[model samples]
Structure formats: structure tokens, C-alpha cells
Target: MAEFKPVKLSSPGHSDDGIAVEVLPYGLTIHKLLVQTDGRIHDIVIGPENPTDHVAQKYTNSIVGRYVNRVPVGTHSFERNGVRGDITALPNESPLVSLHGGPKGFDAVPWTLLTEKDALQLFSKAEAARIRAQPESSFAVFRLESPSGDQGYPGSLIVEVLVALISPDHQQKISENTPQNEVDNRVGSLALVYRAKLREANAVTPVNLTQHWGFNLEASLNKGPETLSVKHHTLTIQADKIAELDSDSLFTGRHVPLTPAHTHQAKPIGKDFPEKGYDDYYLFKDDLQSAVPTRIPLSSFNDDSDFVQDLLRSSDNPERGLRGPPAIELASERSGLKLLFDTNQRGTMFYSNALAKSSAGARKKIHGGSGVSGSGDAYDPHTAVFLELHHPLAAFLHTNEKAGEDTLLTSEELYHNYVRVDITSKQSPA
Candidate 1:
């Protein structure tokens, strides 16, 4: 792992106007993540570092580039008014088009950490992008400059990453019993915000953007069980449609029924997840809304003790070997998480770790306070399911009655795309 610089995370009312996040001088970005009951850090993001390198390779906690996620067989061609661009860097090799901005993806480039003492952040510009890779004939991406036509993409884009440490008060609360703790109405700032913005490069109209990051709520270094829960979690998705996964749980052409339309509705992630994890896009039903309220069933267990074991176990039926399907026991455990969304962007992809399974000689371990343990896919199936987001109502945004709609990306569209996660364990600002 590359040596990461750290950022000092503090409470609210802590900084000046232009500063979205107060950073340190190291190359690393410090994110202030709040911990709850038992004082454990269940809130997972990248950069904190993982025991294995597979995660780093998977772009864990890193800001990745130009176009995120799978773009349909790597061929997203467009003819703006008559100009053609067959973005061939996509779809991973064997492509008629481009994928992820070609091999020199944004993740591969090393970003400079803007720092000032114990506060530092990761920031990248459009000008820096033009230095490394070549562009396409019709479209190009010029870092810090107007968009180039060499990469078959449009307009120049700039992206930044910041992390902060927050909420040090929860140290005692998390250590105490039951998570039904009281909230302090003090004026202390206890959260971190990752602010992202996008404006057209050379005034090139609009663009579609999103963040693709995989998450597993019950992750601990000593604990890596496939145990997960969606039941009683009361998931309030903002969308109307569901994108089903193929046999492998990757995005297929099928759209499944999106359950839990209005209120609280959710099943164990594994209950419906196939042998592999779930990897599909879900359509949002609510637009211009804030907060996707989801409650963890951890404290609402039928039998809290029994539920804990199930949540910690890698598999219930080990005899079936590695291919056995493991349903989640959301009957127990509490993530103490109240995910609140704060973005004009739309869509969220809820994926499950379908590609996870035990390694050659891995063992399942457990912790006293942390609960369960399993080295990702060590004992149970531990794959990653990413929640990806994109432009609000992207599919039908430009469609018209007489003429077909065009989906042309914004130059600044390449700037920032994401689903900002807020650990709202306390009744704080989301």
C-alpha cells in the first residue's frame, strides 16, 4: 500500500467560507467518521487501508475517473449534431469503443495532496489529465484546459477527493451497552463532508456523473464474515425501477421489480442475492429529495444473541461447499446507520458480494466487541456490492416525442460523480 497522509477531522462551525473540508498537509485525506455502540468503527470507506491488496486493486476508497462503471459492452457512441465519437476506451478490451477513459484511468494517476498542517486533501485537475494519456480524433479531455478530442470524450474535467476525521465523542457511547443512547445537543461539529462540483468545460452544456463504490457494513480487520442484513433495515430508495443482475449478478438487460416502494421495506441482502453478489442498477422514484432513510435491524433482533452468531458466521451450511447460497440473517444486528443522501444526482446501485467465497486456507475469526470476523470471503462469501449513482433521471432526460433523445455527456460532467455517504447515527445534519 502507498504511504497515505492523514487529515485531522474536527466538529462543525470549525472553518472558513471557501473551505468545504478542513484538510492537513500530508498527502493523505483524513475523514472524520463517527463510531457508535461499543465504540467500533463499522462505517467503512476506502483509504483507511485493508489487510489485502485486492481491495486497493478494486479501487477501494479511491476516486476513479472520466466515466465510471460499465457502459454497455464498452461502446457508447454519439453524434452531436453530426460529429461522431465512438469512445473506445470502455468495455474492457475486445471493444468497439473505449472504457473507463482507457488504461490510464483516473485511479492510476497519483493526485497531489493539498495540505496545511494536520489537514490535507486529494485534488486533481483537468490540466493534469491531458499530460498522461492521448485523446481521440473527435473528442478529447484536457486537464485544466478546454476539453481535448484525443480521448474520444468531451470537455475538460476536474475531480477532487477529501477525507476528514470526525466525532471523537462516540468513543464512550460505542463502548456502553445498547445503541439506544442519547444525543448531545452541543454545538460541536461531528461530521465530515466530501464536497464535489461540476461546471461545463468550455461551456460544453451538461454531463452525466456518478460515484461507484462497493460497501460491506459489517467489515472489521479481524472480522470478515459474509454476514449481512437488509431485513427490518427499512430501506427507502428514491427510485421506481430495479435493475436485475445476470447469472453472475452483474448488470444484465433485465429490470426486476423494485420492492418497498413507499415506506420501510427490505430483505437480507443474501436472502435474495444469488450465489454471487448482486450487481445491478436501480431506478429512483423520488427526485430532488434528500436522505434515503435506512434503519439497521441489529438492535431489533428476534433473539439478539442467536442473531449475532448468524451475523458473524460465514456460512450456515458449510457442507454445500463454496458454491452454496448463503441467505442473510437480518433478524439481528444494528448498523446504527441512518444513510442520508445530499446531492442533486440520481440513481443508486445496491450490489451484493456475489463473487466472494472462502480462499484456499482461510479461517473465520470473531471479536468480543466488534462481533464477527472473516477475511473477505475467507469463511463465508465476501464479495463487494457497490452503490453507484448517476445523473438525475438520466435515461429519459432528453427524450422527446418527435425526435429521439441524445445522451451527450458534459465536459465538466467528468468532474465529479458520486453517492456521498453520511453516517447519521446521531440526529445530526445530513
Candidate 2:
């Protein structure tokens, strides 16, 4: 196998308020992410310190698709003009599953640097469009044109992804003169917005895209102990059901009630961490929205505990035209870092890095050294967690006939999906 070397690119004046980011043309990967905390800077996402290490590492801070996640291994069928055709999984990485857009997906390819003005823009030759970004909000957009039969899938597709980092300052502002009963809501937070669009003038295809940034809120790749992991982080997913998966980790088209062990109601991740470490999809409840209202009066709560409880509760009726609360929240009390994840998609895939240790071991043989240097033991199990927003895998399955109209995207209609990540300093009760 030939070595894949990634080209590094930088955007001028992108840093703000002690937050810094670095992007790569390969996969438009987020190479370095640093946030200032306690007067010191720390790297939050696990990524290759050196550009060459990217090829051997997991999709570390990179965008993966044609399709995100797994599509069952075999010949799957789709419909076109009342005719049936089959698209088979490449089976490049796994023998039984087609993971992350086959063996040579977007993450493995190098993109062209189109423009570096307000935001960085990258173009993939295979996929006609460009991926753009801006420094102020740390926003990046991916625009592409996928020709029919590009990746074993049927029909042509035009995909666009908009990713932005929304700071707490942009959220609903709280007033100093507000009543004492109201929550004093001042927390440093950032939201990552992933908006995707599919436009095709003549054909329809399966579309599922997600941002795969594995987060370790407490530890930093540039600082802290080598063995530091995300095992201590607390998790809560606003989901009551889960999609069932077979041994190979493909969705079995079944939605089962969440088990007690899988319950994430402000609970420690390690408390009931699954043996496989969360490679499952949590189907969020329908009544929630993405953002917390700027302020809520104390009349609704009786005490501090009630305040926390109320804050965690999903809005019964979100405002007439507003995004809802996060589908999941991951926090690290040790480092005072908290992450709120909100998405308009139907489900969120939570993956604990349980296989990292083994994967890293295998990567060492192909790559001269470990995937990343200066980070000791950073590839351990449960070192980080990935929350991906998208339709359930079942939506893409085609057994004997085409999927229902709701699951597939058409040329006449536009498909838009949004995912928001709110990074905040956990506030303490008064």
C-alpha cells in the first residue's frame, strides 16, 4: 500500500478569545483544536500531531461519507425510473461491513484549497464542489457533486455540509437585573452546527452525513497524563429507544426500548458503559428542541435540585420556530468542560473508543510509528466518544423493494439536517 500524506493548511486570523483550530485538506480534518481554560490552553479533540500520521489514524476529526457509519455488506438494491439496480459494499476495511463510505471514502482523499478568505474552502476533484470555512465562527462548508455510480450507490448526488462553531455570546443573552428566582445563566459555551443539503435535478439516493469529532473533554493531547481517558465523563442522551444491531454492528431494522444500562440521565459513562462501549444509535424523543431558552424563572422550580431537573427536561412545546435542545450532553467535571449535542436528525450514534487500542496496534505495523506522537497512550479504549447525527441505518436498507418515500431524498425536494454542539463551563448551583 502506498503511504498517504496529508497537506496542511492554515487560515489567517482564525483564533478568537483563546480558541484556535487547524484544518487539513485531507478529509477537511480538524487537525488541532485548542481551548483556553484556567489561563492555560488544552487540545480537546484527538488528532494527528503531524500531518503524515493522518492516514493510519481513525477518522480523527475528519469528515467521513458518501455515507457515514456502516452499510451492510452485500448487494443492496435501489430504484430508478421504475427499474431496480443493486449497489454492493466495497468491503475494503471490514470483511462483513462497509464502514464510512467504503475503503476509499472522502476522509482518505485530499481536497483542493479553493479560497481562504472569510472561510477556508476546499474542492475535491472527484466530487465537483468545494468545502469552505470562516475564522470568526470556525465555520466550514462542504459542497460536492457525486456522479451516478460513483461509489456503488445509484443516481447522482449533490452534497453540501456547513459546519460552524457558535459561541455562548451568540446565544440568548441574560440580563443582570433579572429576578433572583431566575437562573443566573452565564456559561461559556460553543455550538457546532452541521447543516447538510442534497440537491439532484433528476435522481434520488440515500443521504446520511454526520460530523465525527471524537471528544475527550477532560484530557488534552498536548497536555495532561498520557493515560488520561474519557471514562470519567458523564453522559445523558434524550432518548427512550435504541436501534437494534446484529453481530456485525449493522442496524437490524428494529427499534427496542432502551435498557437500564443504556440509560443516560445525567449518569457517569463508566457506570453502565456497555461491554462494546456504545456503538449504538439512540432514538431521541420527538418533543425536544436544540437550544435552551435564555432564561427560565424560578417559579417553575422549588429548589436547586428542581432547577437542575427542569433544565434537563425537554421542552414540552418548543417555540413556533426554534431548534430544540441537544440530543446528548457529555461533561467532564474534572476539567469543567461540558458538551451539549443537538440535532434535527432522527438519531444519534454514540461510539465509545473501545476498539482504539486494538486498532492502534494494527496501525503500527503499516505506519512506521503510532498514529500520533507527543500523546502517550492516547489511543486507549474509552479515551473518547463520538456523537453522530443522522437517520437510522434502517432508513437506507433495501431488501426486496425500495425504502419508503420518507427515507429517501428526491431531486425535486431539498434535504437539510442540522447538528449543534454546545461547549460550556458547567455552572454550579447557587
Candidate 3:
């Protein structure tokens, strides 16, 4: 195994523009994400000090997969492409349920950092064209090859993750002129793009890759690395329905309308839910528009010269790329920071770290102090929130086929999805 090394990225031409990130190939983890806004730098991601700590503390900002969520013991078996496989892997959760790919999922393994040339092939045709047009953007790609039967999953899976950071100024094409009003709304952002495929011919497998990151928008270095609880943050989720779960928190293959308890419309995150905070899957409504409207012109990024036809095709093929409305919006009045979360996935599993407790473990720091935790620099319950983007919970269960379209993969198809976070500062005009 290659030694684990951390890679740092910053927005092009402005390394100090309050945008910096550190990523580890181990588990494809995002170790640090510091964004400057409101004249302060905020380390918004919850992570451990040592990159190796991710192996034991897997929930930190790392990629989770094979199957992203839960898989009941008996429902672990699947049949696809006329082949059958049973995932008898040891269960990590109670009641013999497999959680996050049965312990040694993608988060527990090391991935290979692909060279620029090699990674170029992994980017979608539209993304490749976009990257070519914006060479100044900062991005890194990591690859992982999972052999058949690893974690009891069927096929050999080749997965690639592209993490990219774009500054507010470059959110749109460089050739376009920005209006003053639009410039104020422009935000610095980070996007994670995933691509996966079966390596063996006719092989079949269940794959649900998702990025798990606990965000603490209250993180800040304005007054010497001061960190606050996420309870103070207000949150909104654009969904009309939520998953119905059993007592053990496993999906019950039923959907229910969002109740006041789970429905968030700019509500205080800490006070809106039950004592532990929300830990449920919110399904996107059919009328939901594509997440976070962007001026990047995704439809025209194709290489084809038939612009009109390409646009029409892109409209018809919503699944081809990132689509869906800003699934979540979180903001902190104190920090004057707002997080616009969007993804192409069907739903998001929202967790408020209800069970998380202060740890003695080391954490990443800036300006000689730590961020993303409550006072005393310890992560307490409700200090951070995780918005896991992917298919519905337990999508691998054959009974929930309709809930998960692309979770079951065959050699003929490729897996693709993305999660984009736009961090904008809502500062009052001086």
C-alpha cells in the first residue's frame, strides 16, 4: 500500500481568498475545508487530526460506499443481470444490519490518486469540457478498485472521485461578464463528482456511494479559532416526503409526508427536531427543480457542435448529470455564512450527530487552533450535521428496487452523481 499523503487545494490565482481544502487518499477523506467569509475564515468540516484516525472514526468527512447506508441481514442478497450474490458480511450495526458497506466499506480502505491524464478519462463528457474551459480551477481525482466478493459485493468496481474547488468569480464561464448584483450572490464552492463502473464483463453489484461530511457553519477564526455549536444554525430542506423507518432506524420501504418534526423551512436545527436531532432520509419531491441553479451552462458543455439538439437531449436526460433543487440550505447568523447543499441524488440522509460526544482525539487546525467543534474544542452532540447524498436507505434490498434506480449496477452502466456546496456570506452592506 502506498503511504497516505494529504493533498491541499485552493482556488486558482487566489490562494488566500478564504478557500482552502486538504484531502487524504485514505478513504478519499476531506480533512479540511476552510472558507473565508464575513472577514473570517471558517473550518467547516469535522475531522480527526491524524489521517489514519479515519479508519476507526469512519464517519468524518469521507466517502462511504459499496452500499452507502443500511442493509438488513436477510435482505443483503441481490440478483442482477441473471446473477445472484449474498452479502453475508459481518454486520456493524445492531440487529445484524450491515452499515455503510459492512465495516470495511470504501471509507476503511486506501484509494489511489490518479494522474491528471488518467483522471481526465473518468470525467463525464460534459465535465471534461468544463474543466478544459476552466483550467485555473483546482481539482484532484482519486481512484479505487474493489475486487469482486470484497465486502461480499458481486462485481469488481472501479470508482473515481473528483474533488474540485471554484472561486466565486469563476463560478461561470470566464468569457461572460458578470453584473454587479450577481457578483454579490456569487459564492466560493466545492463539488464532489463520482464515477463508478463494473470492471468485469456482465458482472453485477449493488453500489451506493455517498460523501459523508459533518458541517459546522459556526466554525470561525475571527476571534482566535472560536467554534460554536450547529444548534444555532437555521436549516431548510426542500422535500415534501420522508422515509418511513422501523424502530431500529432501518428503512421500512414506505414513504410518509413530511411532518412538522422533520419538515424544515428555515427552522432552527437544534430546536426543530426531537431531542437527538434529525436522522432520517428526506425524499425529493417530483416537482423539485435541479439543485442550486448555476450559470455554468451545463447543457452546453458538450463537445458536439449541434448546440440546439444537445440542449434538448440534456433536458430529456436529467439523470445524465447533476440535477435536483438545493436539497438543503443551512445558515448561521453569527458567522454570516450560508451553506447551499445540492446533489443529483434522489434523496439525502440527514444526521445531526445526536450521538456524537466530545473526543480526546486530535483535530485539524488553522491559526494554531481547531475549528468545527463546540467550546473546549470537543465535538458534542448536535455540534455538526451530515447531509448524505445518495439513493434511498437500504436501496440494496431487492424489495426496495423502485426506491433505488442506479444503486444496482451491471457492467453495461456507469454510476454517476455529485454533491455541491456553495458557501456564501450574507453580510449586511456597510
Candidate 4:
């Protein structure tokens, strides 16, 4: 086992409103996300007490790729050379499926930091020779020359990831006399942007990548009286359909309308935990694109009159409907903490951390200097939730992109995906 060494990065000059982020080379995992709220600081993301524990635990705050979610284990048929052929994938934890790119996937390996300027750029490459030699080990095909017979797939691949954090201008906008309502809206807003690009030309491959960052809005980095479980947090997702899962927890390739109980319309998480904890994929509503005017092009309108009217409306009220409702929102009334998630991905996996355990000495003391001591505590089910954004699992199996389609990526084209997460504080109702 390798020892854990983490590098901490903060905003220039350690601004009070800025966030302190920690990353580990192993898995290029985000170990901590600290932000100031009220008079105290909170680590809203769930993480292991010890950095090395990341390897033993599930993909927490790690970059999962190659294939983001699940694929059938063993040999599976894929399109190659315009003919159906078989490809083998590595299996982990489950014999019937390969998860997060198998046991040795990107989440389980170390990534090199290519640059550290306005954003963090981490690079990992899968060499054709190495991938061919280790057919049983999981490997990333993007941003690498996979070649034919590499991981039972054809062609080479190349991929790149860029991560950036944007903080609000609290110093300039926030003042001592700032209204409580205004301050509530201004403070604690942190934005995380994840952008990925496939860099191979004339190559076609299955590429789905996502970050696994769990949130406990009311939770504290230091064990103290303010620490609260996520049981009381309210959740809302702008999804009307969810992917169905089988007994083994793999998607059954079916989509079902969400029942009232499963609908996340600002409902408390504890109310639904008894009915099988949430580990399902929520499909974003089709009309979500309309919420943003930029996504609605002039060509979408049949007549010049309608197009001109819409253009006027959009320009006259640029910020009017932009802040409607996010794809997902999680809030804790007790701490007045709220988190909003938005993404261009088609699906978001909502996992409630039902399998976490505090036993076996897996727990450790909190980080930072808060004068709070450890109580040998364990996290209960639903104490935290992970929202992973990505395309539908096994989408390549059903997609047939034409040569010039914008959605289709050719050797000269690139696939770019983005997800934004914003953290804010809201005032409790009077």
C-alpha cells in the first residue's frame, strides 16, 4: 500500500470567501472542500479521515472514467470495423458487472498533475502496449492510443480533464450592513466546473466521466455541536423519470416514471430511506434545456416574428429566467446551508451512502484546527448523498451517430462535457 500525501490549494491570498481544496495524486481525488459559513467553516463533502483510506472505500470525491458507470463483466459484443465483435472487461466487487472501469480503473490509480494555474489539469494516459499486456486490468481508452485489441476494443483514444473553482466577490459585494436576505443569497456560493475533452481523431470510443463527490451540507469538518446529519436535509431534483435497477443494483435498461415518494420535490431524505435507499439514476426532464435562453436558438422558431420577439425578451431580461430551478438542490434548514447542482449530462446518480460503515476502525479525527475531539462516531445511512452527472449507461450500445451530426465525434471532432455545482446559504423562513 502506498502512503497518502495530499496537496492543498486555496484561493490567492486565502480570501475569506475563497475555498480551500485538497487533492491527492492517487486517483487525483478531491480530499476536502472547505468553505466559511457564518462565523465558522464547514467541510461539506464527505471524505475519509485518513487519505489512504480512499483506496479501500468506494469512489468518494474521485475522478471515475474510461466508462463512468457500469458495463457487463467478461466478454461483451461491440461494434468494430462495422462488424459485431466481443470485448472483455474487468470485474470488481460483482462478478456479473464491471463498475467504474473495474478494480484498477482510473479511480484506483494515480494521475499526474499537468498544470496548476487558473484551474487544475490532471492527465492520465493508457498506452497501447501496456493495455494489451494487461487485458484483465481495467484501463482508460480516451486520450490514449488504444489501438485494436486494446481492452478488447478497437482504435486509440485520448482524453483530458480541467477542474476550476469560481468564488463570488464577497469582499466587494458583501458589507456589514448587507441585508440578511441579500447576505444569505451572496455568501457561501462556490462553483466547481468540470470540463472533459476527447482528443483522438477519426477514433470512436465510449467515453463517460464524472466526479463522485458526496455532500453533507450541515456536516462540519470539526466534530462539534454544529455537526448535523443529512437526515433532515431536503432534496429536489428536476427529473420526472429514473432508470430502473435490478436486484444486483445494475441498470435494467428501463426507464420508469417516478412515483410520488421517489419524487424529490424538496422532500426530506429520511422519509424515503425505509423504502430502499436511493441508489438510482434520475433522468433530467426533456424541457430543462428551455430554461436557458442560450440553449434555445433562433432557428428553433419557425417564423421571424417569433424569433424577434424571443430575442427581445431574452435581451431585455437577460437574468430573468436564468435562475429558475437547478437540476438538483439539497438544503439543510438547521444550518441554513444549500447546494445546487447543474449539468449538461443526461442523468444524475443519487446514492445515499447506504453502504458506509463506521466500524472496523475506518473512522478518524476531523481535519483542521477546531478544538473538537473525535468521539469514535460512525455515519448513519443517508448521512450523505452523491450526485453523479453523466450520460446514460451503455449509451454507445444504442447510438449510431452520422458522420456530420453535431452529437457524433469524428477524428477531427471532440466531445466536451460540463457540470456545475454551486453552494449557497439561505435564510430560514420567518
Candidate 5:
């Protein structure tokens, strides 16, 4: 791990009405997201107090990749170039599963910062326009290259993450030169765009990346004597079908209708949650793209959109290329804070921090800082929730036909997906 300082990003030229963020080079981690709502600034994203603490906290707002979730051991063999080979990933979880890319995944590695010139060369004119439309937005491009067989993967992979903070006032710039119906209305949004390419032409490897950032909306808004937790947060996932999991929490290769407990309809997170909070994958039930107006032309960025489109158009089945809705919502009533999640990934994994222990000792050095105050004590079980967007777990073990398209990429194809978070105040009119 490398020691890096925090890079501050503020929208609207550091005005109080916009969003501010902090980033670190280690793990390409998001240190803080300070959202101003109702005259108060709330730090919606939670992690360790100091920037260096991120090295020990692997998944705390870090870009988790190569493979997002658990992979059953012995299931590493894949057919590439008409020949089958095995990926010998370390068994980090017990002795049967490799949890999070074999221990030292992308989250645990230090990524290099890409120069603005090099980063701009990767995009087209239209994409560059979109990037410039964000006024006073700070852009940080983090690059990471994973060598072939680094973690038993088959090919060398290069990945870049673009973190941008689009202040609320930039809506005017983003909506310019667009039809009234095609405009994007999101405000105070943070865009995290991930792009990857395999270094070898004949090599094949599994690629599913996601950011495992936990959210405690009221972490900085608690002013009363009572403590705040994520139990009071209301959630709504736009999916009716969920992936079935066995006792070990691995995918069972079956789809099950969402039960009442798992199904969310502006429902409070605390009610009907399992003993350890939610850790389930939900499959979308509707066509998200149809409802979402295409803006900025993502296909121009050399992403896997073409491959996914071909799959959607080729298959006669309506569910062949199902994706989550443009936005999944979570709200905190106490703080009057609302978070809207938009992604292009296949599905979402909702995980509440049910098994998290106290962080008071680790956060002791960051108490009473400038932005927000940390309790330096354990809030409770389910203190925060993680909404991760990525391909299905263990998709690398299955073929594209079985796991849908773009689950694994070829040498000629580039991997791209994004998760955008838009924060606003409930007190404001919708």
C-alpha cells in the first residue's frame, strides 16, 4: 500500500449550495461526499476518518474489481482460445471461496493518477463536452494495471476510473443543446465511470467491477441525543426477481421471486430484515434504457455497449438483457437526505453492514474534523448500506450465453460501466 493525501473536489466553485468530495489514490477510494441539504452539509458516505485508514479497510468506498463478489473454489477453469485453463486464485474465504479477487484485489492496490492530457485522449469530442459541462467540477482519473496471473486471472487488464463531481448548478450546462425530453435533470451528482481493456488479444478473463461504498445518511446530521443508523432509511429497488443463494451465500444458479422481506417498496430497511441485514442480489424486471434517455453517447467511449446491444437485439427472449432501472432510491427521513443511484450494470447487490464491529478506535484520530463529526463509537448493526452495481457473482465461471453478455470480455472489446449517485434534500420540491 502507498501513502497518499486527500484530493478535494468541490462543485459550483466551492459554494455552499453544491456538492463536495474527497478522493485518495490508494484503491481509488472516495474518502468523503459532503452534500448540502437544507442549509446543512451532510457527509453521506462513511469510511475511516483518516485517508491512510483506507489501506486497512479494503472495501470502504474502494473500487473492487477483477471480480466483485465471492467465487467458489474449483470453479476457476474457463475455456479460452478453444483451450480450457484454470485460474488459481487464493482461497481467501475459508477454504472454498475466494472473496473479493483473492485478498489483494484492486481495492487493496494503489492506483496511479492519469494526466489530464492522457485521460482526455481516451474520450471523443462529445464525451469531452460532457466532461467540460460540469462547471467547477474536479476530475480525477486513477489508472491501475493488473498483470496476467496476478491473481490467477488469465490476461493483463488495464483499468481507469473517472471520478467527477457535478454540482447542482451545472444542470444548465449539461442540459444545453439537448431536446427538452432528452435532458438529464439530476443535480449534485457524482459520476464514477470505469473503463477497462484486456492487454492480450487471445487472453480471456473475468471482469466484474463495483464500488463497495457504505452510506449512512445521518452520520453527520445527528444533533439530538438519540443515535442514528441506517434502519430508518427507506429503500426502493426496481426489481421483482432476485438471484437465489445457497446457505453459503453463493449463487445457486436459480432465480426466485422476491419475498416480502426482500422486496422493497419505499419500505424501511429495518423492518423484516434478516438477522445479519440484507446481502442479496436482485435482477431487474423492466427495460431500464427505454425509460432512460440516452445522453452523452456512452457508446463512443469504446465500452461494451455494442456487445450488450447485439445481445439484446439478437435474443428473442425479453429478459435476455435485463438491467436495473435508471435510478434506485434510498432516503433518510431524519436528515431529509435522499440518494438516487443510477447505473448501467446488470444487477445490484444490496448489503447492509450487519456484521460490522466498532470503529471508535480506528477513527479516533479524525474526531471533530472540518467537514463532519464521527461518533468514534459503534452506531449499531445495519449502520450503513451498500448498493453495488456489477455483473452477477461468479459470472466468470459461466459462459456469456448462460451469464448474459459482457460478463467476460475479449481482447478486442473494452469493459465499461458506471454508477452515478445523485443526492438531494427531501425538503425541496421534487
Candidate 6:
């Protein structure tokens, strides 16, 4: 390994009326919460110097996990050395059900930071593994140990989330000296990384850990439903059949369409328009073909509006062909931490930022006088998408973790799956 440079942490930047923020060298900044003079508690996120190049792609500034977005009860069992332990309901839910490993998730507590070259070690000792995440690297990890009578929940769970800023240099061929015609594998791109470990102190149990990111590609304050397109995107799975939804169109398994279901394969956001949004998941069929590779213009996604067509033409990358099918590599930067699932937890959630409208986005709330937005510019259907790796919430019927004990999920690594994830101007299959 190359010698790592020490991370540079700075003091908080002063704010006139709000909280202050601190910057980190590895493209990270921390926005500590502040109590306003008006008796209001404001939320702040740490970010990198270049929010777009370094921060936005990092998903690190905040630690976002707490039972990490809805979990089903009864879906998980508790055991200690083969002995059955009692389980409880999860807190924070309206109806009460076990969500993110029973409260005290990594994001709920503070973390100790030990920085080294190219890596930051954060440790948390909460009752259960707890952590939070922003759109960039620089996450926190909390830990805890069970003290007594395996009360409502079973065995003790120990989880450690190792977070880092994944800013590896892109080995693309773009150089000052290379002939304009020759290609160099040295393109500069900025990104972040998050990876963690979970173990049961006594027995074997199922564990699931995932990140939550809200993306808006158009830079619209209301996360307008920008255009969208999925090209040459093929989903392959081992299952012959998968779960379907009751009323909604959402699927409950790592759904991928069968080879014959290519009818809806490569399409445009303009094709679907405003009538509906994509908050559903499709099951992957077993014999699916591998994804094709392409860069730059992912796919031409625009409405009949001449303005929309003109916008894409002006910024689209030449390497990324605007014509033909968009190649689908489905690649994400944080290697080795790719999600693998067991049959017990066999679904993936595909959620569009359905709730992030204009004023509802990251904009600061204006006081008094009439503010902007509410003009139908909030969360549109085309801004961005989320491919969550988890099980259906319906599985766990009842859950509670007030026991202040450990409730961790532990499992083995499965297959190696890679997905192409883009944060900038390049095409889909770069």
C-alpha cells in the first residue's frame, strides 16, 4: 500500500445565526447542529470542499441508519449458541415494529475517529450497531454489548461500520501530453466509500446493513422530475419466480425481468412522463444476458419540449453516445461491500425520490414573508432513483429493542455482483 498522508481536520466555520461547519482534507466537511438564537434546533451536514466533485458522491457527511428505513417483524429470529433468545419490538416506528437492528443504530450515537492514510476508523459502542451517513464519505460507527438476561431480544450483536472517502483516481486516458487522438486511462473523478462489519457475540443470525441517499441530478431546488433512461440494462437472478405487490406495482424480491420481458427494458423518462413515477422493483430473471458497456450520454431521455432536447445536446459527453441503447454496467465505487442476500431476505427496493419536492429539498427554510416553490417544482418523477438492498418490511410483524441489548444480524458473503453508479457528466457504462 502507498504511504497515506495524514488527514487534515479544521475548526468549525462560524455562521452568523446558525451552526458552524468544519472541513476535512479527504473531501469532507462536518456541519455540527446548532441551536439558533431563536430557540430552534437546526440540522446541518458535513460536506467536502467541492460538494459536487467530492461531497455529493460521497454520501458520508451524515450517518443515515436507524433500523435503516422500515423492516418487517418475525422475519428475523434470535439465537445464542443454538438456544432461542427472546426478541422485542423496534422503537421509532408509529405502530412499533423492529426496524434498524432495534434502535441505537449507527447514526443514533457519536463515533470516535482514528484517521490514517486514505482511511478513517470510526468506532461506536452502542447497544446495537449505530451509524449515520451523508452524501459523501466520513461516517460514524457505534457499538454496544448485551449486559444480562437475553430479555425480549436474543443474543448480543456487535457491528462496526468502517467508512472511507473512495477518491481513487480514474485510470482513463485523458492527458496533457498524449496526442489528442490517443487515449489515456487517467481521467480524474471524485467519489466516496462505506463498508462495515457485523457479528453476533454468540451465534449465527441474519444481518442487513444499507445506505440511504437522496439524489437530484438536475440541480433543481425542488428535485424536479428530470428526464431518465435505462439502456441495455439486464437483470439476472437465480429465482424462477418472485414476489409481487398487493396494491402498488412494487415488487418484493430482487426482481429482474425475464429475457422475454424486454418490452419495458430500455425506455425514456419522457416516455413515462408525469402520470406515474418509478417507486417499484423488478425481479431479475435467471438467464438474463450481461449488460453492455457505454459511456457519456447514457441514453437520450427528453420530452417533446425543444428546450429539454437542447439541454441534453449542450452537455452530453461525446464518448457517451446519445444514440442507441444505454449500456448497463451498474457499477458502484465502494468495492468489497457490495450487497449479497440470503433466501430469507430476497428483495431489493427501487425508490425514486418521490418525496423531495422543490422547497422540500435541501434549501434553507425562509422565514416570514412569502417564500418560493409550491409551484409544482418539488420532487418530480425524473430526478433520481434508489436501488435499496433489503427484505420486505412485511416480514417482521412485531419488534422491540428497548432492552438496551445487542440485536445484530450476521451472515456470510454470497456472490460477487457489481453495478455501475455515476455521479457526473460521463455516460452510464464508463
C-alpha lDDT values of all predictions = 0.33, 0.56, 0.67, 0.56, 0.65, 0.29
Q: Model 3's lDDT to the true fold?
A: 0.67
Q: Once model 6 is optimally superposed onto the true structure by TM-score, how far is the C-alpha of residue 192 displaced, in angstroms? A: 7.0
TM-score of 1: 0.54
Which window of ten consecutive residues has the lowest lDDT sum in model 4? 307-316
- Which of candidates 1 and 5 reaches a greater TM-score? 5
Among these predictions, the greatest lDDT belongs to 3
lDDT of 5 by residue, 1-430 (tens): 3436777787642234667788888877888878775567777776777677676555878888788888786546776335444578678776877777887898887888765466543444556555545443467767888998877777888887778775543333444566543332333667777778777766667788888888877767554223246877899888887877777777766667999999888999988988767888887655653332112233344432232222111112211222433447887777666777767675788989766666432332222223222344643457678888876777656453252532666565566677676665544321
Deviation in Å, model 2, residue 369 alpha carbon: 13
Tens digit of per-residue lDDT, candidate 6, span 1-430: 0111223211111132222223232222232222121222322221122223222223333333323345444334554235443345454444444444454444333344433322222122221122223222323322333322222344343333332211112334366776533331211111122223223333333334444433222221121112212211222223333344433332242323433332233233234333454454333332332232111111231122121111111112322322212222221111100111111123344445454444432332311112223333233333344544433333322232212112233222111111222212122121
lDDT of 1 by residue, 347-404 (tens): 5555543443444222222211221223333423333345555542223122331132
Tens digit per residue, CA lDDT, model 3, 268-299: 87665587577889887776645431112323
Where is model 3 more than 4 Å wrong at Cα?
Answer: 1-3, 12-16, 80-85, 117-121, 124-133, 170-185, 221-227, 289-325, 363-377, 398-406, 428-430
Clash pairs, model 5 backbone:
none
> Model 4 over residues 48-95: C-alpha lDDT tens digits?
777887876658888786677777777755442343334476777588
Candidate 2 residues 170-244, lDDT tens each?
323458786533422223223333322234355556666666777876655233333256777788888888888
Going through the candidates in the order shown, the clash numbers are 64, 11, 5, 10, 0, 75
Question: How far out, in Å, is residue 40 in model 5?
Answer: 1.1
TM-score of each: 0.54, 0.73, 0.81, 0.73, 0.81, 0.45
Among all windows of ten consecutive residues in candidate 6, which has the lowest summed lDDT? 331-340
